[model samples]
Target chain A: MKLGRLNHVGVATPSIERSVAIYRDRLGAEVVREPFDLPAQGVRVCFVDTPNSQIELIEPLGADSPILKFLERNPEGGQHHLCFEVSDIAQARDFFESGAVRILGPTRIGAHGTPIFFLHPKDMGGVLTEIMESPKQAH
Target chain B: MKLGRLNHVGVATPSIERSVAIYRDRLGAEVVREPFDLPAQGVRVCFVDTPNSQIELIEPLGADSPILKFLERNPEGGQHHLCFEVSDIAQARDFFESGAVRILGPTRIGAHGTPIFFLHPKDMGGVLTEIMESPKQAH
Candidate 1:
């Protein structure tokens, strides 16, 4: 697949508010958006934009949220996933198909109207990966 | 601190060679640098540069390596630390001090010739964060 760029970095946190504060107050990243709850995904997300990339803070709203479980097990926050911007989502899917990696979606519109697909972490040595195709809005 | 940009995303893995292939072959990130073994840290690192940020694949070379111990606990790879580039090394140190976050260094450079410091994960809600001054290469 033709990878465009590093779209954004997803950070799973126990509290989105706290994470947002750290990024904005301490790191100097501007808060681009407020927390938006997504019940289907069991998450409340906030976005911060930097010069080069965006920082996504994801907090689990329910006990069943995967991120909640993740925090329960590993409290230390680290890299969650690396998203690569692609020109064609279908072509990106095909590339993963050639490999043993499991595709989570063919294509789906994400937070900012960007098409994206998540690769199963099991296939990528436990690192969650996402391929996205869309023009990101400047915050 | 005045954050410049994200320097790189660090990934701890069992095999840098295999990880490098997956990132380069599947993800399409160009291999800008080769694997370099840091004997002092007991780990090997390979760097891939994308448009926005860098992907670093790290593998422990010895049992004493911190990566080895991390892998021992979290065999499944996930998010590691997120590093932010700072314009001034001393100012970056001051930020941490102002926040009462424990600082790991105001010391020597790593990988590239950039002065760096680490904020304890406990202070950042389990996230390992690094503040790095722009490298001399950019000067």
Candidate 2:
């Protein structure tokens, strides 16, 4: 599989507002989009654009939120995953599957409006990884 | 601190040779530099150059290597840190310190032969971040 650029680094946080302050006031980041809810994923997210990639701040939005357990383990939150773009999500998924890498779930529409799938941490050397469609367009 | 490009994402591993196989044979990475040891840091590292940034694979050289604890917690190894380039290391260090951010140690030469320092994870949203001088001239 051809690996593309680093799209974004997902940061799980208890509050997107607080994460925004750190990226903005402390890091001198000038652009931080307003936080929005992804009810489908049960999380609120905001993008902190960087020179090369971005930082995606995500906060649990519902009781069944996937990141709820992560927050329970790390109350102050932490890096949840690293996302990389793939020219074609399907092809990339096929490649990982062929290599016996475990993918978490079926490809779904991501926050970027692109099809994305998360690779299980165990199969990814202890780091949760997201593979997303490049030049993301509505899926 | 002026954030330059994402230099690389450091992944701690038990073996660089094994990680190289995954990147080269599976991920289709074309360039995988030879592994070298940094005695000062007590870790061996190698660079896998990507289009935009790079992936750094680090293996502990000794039992007391800082990464040993990480590998202990995750026998499979894990993402150790994210490194970003900075035009001036001292200036970036000053900015972080002024913001009450914790610096792990005095600036030291990094794997890239660049002056670098790790910011305390607690002050960096639970991500151990590295700030390094870019276009590193061998010191």
Candidate 3:
């Protein structure tokens, strides 16, 4: 698989509003985008930009949201996943297969219009790993 | 506090060598530094360079290491902390204090020569955050 770059780091939080304030007021990161509700995923997401990479703050909007259960177990805070920009999603899937890692999706368009797939946490140690087609606007 | 670019994202894993192979062979990240042991922290770290930030794969050197405990609970995989580079560690501590979040440390240098401090995970919704002075080479 041809890896392009580190896309963005997903952060799970109890409240997007609170996380936004902390990222902005404390960390000096600017809000690149406002919080958007993803009813399909049962969460709300906000993007913040630093000098290098973006931080995605996610808040569970429904009880059934996976992030909700994750927060319940962690309670403090934790990273959701590390997304890597890939040249080809299919090639990435093939690479994972060679390593015997389960691929969650072949290639699906996600929030940012990128074709992405997730490598099961069991294969990647404990962190959720993602491989996605490089964004046109990627640096 | 003047925010510098992100330095690295730390990931705890059972074996640094295995993680390194995946990152280097599959992700195309080059191993910029060899593994270094920090007895005080009970960790051995290897650094990989991404386009925007570095990835630090940490392995606990001893069974009593804090990372060992983390791996025991989160056997799947997860990020350890998000580290940001700052121009002044003291200023970063002051900035964190001005906010509602509690600071975990103040201007203490790490084994890597960067002065760092942590923000209490409670305020950040469980994400262990570190603010540090940019490494000499980074500056």
Residue lDDT tens for model 3, A1-139: 5555677888888877777777777677754687888776677888787788788788888778878878888775568888888777777777777876788845677656778878887777666887878877736
- Scored by lDDT, model 3 comes in at 0.76
Question: For each candidate, C-alpha RMSD in Å?
Answer: 2.3, 2.6, 2.3
Q: Report the C-alpha lDDT of model 3 over B1-139, residue by residue, as the tens digit.
A: 5445767788988888888777777566754578888776688888877776778788888777878778887764458988888877777777777778898744566646778877877777677887878766733
Give stretches of model 2 more than 4 Å off. Answer: A136-139, B136-139
How close is every model to the real structure, measured as TM-score?
A: 0.90, 0.93, 0.90
Candidate 1: clashing residue pairs, number:
3
Off by over 4 Å in 3: B62-64
**Between candidates 1 and 2, which one is better according to DockQ?**
1
Q: lDDT tens digits, residues A34-135, model 2? A: 788999889999998777778899999989999999999878788888888889988998888888688898999898888999988876667788988987
The best-first sequence of candidates by DockQ reads: 1, 3, 2
Q: Pick the candidate with the highest lDDT.
A: 2
DockQ of 1: 0.61
Residues A10-100 of candidate 1 have per-residue lDDT tens digits of: 8888777787777777777754687798776677878778778787778877778868667767575545777878877777787788887
Judging by lDDT, tell me the better candidate of 1 and 2.
Answer: 2
Better of 1 and 3 by TM-score: 1
